[model samples]
Target: MKLIGSTSSPYVRKVRIVMAEKKLDYRFEAEDVWSEQTQIASSNPLGKVPCLIMEGSEAMFDSRVIVEYLDTLSPVGKLIPQGGRDRAAVKTWEALADGLLDASILARLEATWPSRQANERSQAWIDRQMEKIDLALVAMDKGLGDKPFCSGIHFSLSDIAVGCALGYLDFRFPALDWRARHPALEKLATKLALRQSFTDTLPS
Candidate 1:
């Protein structure tokens, strides 16, 4: 198995965290997906990070799919729930987190472009996305109240997905004041993020 992505990508970091939590072994191919036409784009056709090429000629794209597949590699620790409403909730959390990343990345690219090409008109679009982020945080806090992790009772894939989301915000949009606003999430992330899986995979 081989994973191809850049070190600074949150999606890639999520896969790395899953691999560590599941204790799966694989070769890593670090490439900037946005750099140029490369093997990652050819293999996955999405031109995205965290594309996993399996040994049996299977190419898995998207962090969610890649992480889920990697979780099946080990028996001791399962990152994603097997089935039920719990699994649906985990998938929902992942969707929200990944959506937030997409929105953030768009805003970042819009900001980084040449001033003439910059889309200042899209600030409202980004603001709407931020509102979704806030709503998702509130939902997570309510669902996670007084619990050790999300999805109730176990540290499932939901936790890792949300953790990566929060870490990405910390890395890119520190002005959002996430920790100050959500102390519960702050403590939760602080407690669980100490593991090497979280610490080492932080966005650079």
Candidate 2:
């Protein structure tokens, strides 16, 4: 398998961490989707990063889809539950974490994308996205109260997704000071950082 994405993408990092935890091997193809010369559209119609090319040349886009498929490939370290409410809970945590990433990335693009003229940029839109991130953090911290992991006792996909999101914030929006606001998440991130999977995939 070949993973096509930039190191800076949180979604890509999430997939990488999942693969690492599962002890899967794959080639990394770095691509800058933002560049006009990028060939991302050949693999992904949406021109998104983290497109996985399987052995037979089949393609899988979207980090959530890729990670779930990867968990089924090997039982080395099951990240998703087989069935029941536990599966739903883990998926919910993943959605929340991804949503946070969505908001933060949108806010970042609004503020930093060079394609948009200064007058075209909307501070209001950026503020709204930031607000979503803030609310998501509060909910994540509350949901994680006194738990060893986001979903339950075992470290799962929930923690992987949340860790990637927090790592992105640290890489792009450090001034947000999320750690101070949500100490529980900070603790979780600290623990995650110690993992070889998380450490190896840290965004450059």
Best candidate according to TM-score: 2
Q: What is the TM-score of each predicted model, taking all chains together? A: 0.91, 0.98
Question: Which stretches of candidate 2 lie above 4 Å from their native place?
Answer: none
Local distance difference test, each candidate? 0.81, 0.96
| Per-residue lDDT of model 2, residues 1-204, tens digit only | 999999999999999999999999999999999888999999999999899999999999999999999999998999999999999999999999999999999999999998789999999999999999999999999999989999879999999999999999999998999999898999999999999998888899
| Candidate 1: residue 125 lDDT (0-100) | 68
| Residue range with the least summed lDDT across 10 consecutive positions in model 2 | 109-118
Model 1 deviation from native, Cα RMSD in Å: 1.9
Best by lDDT: 2
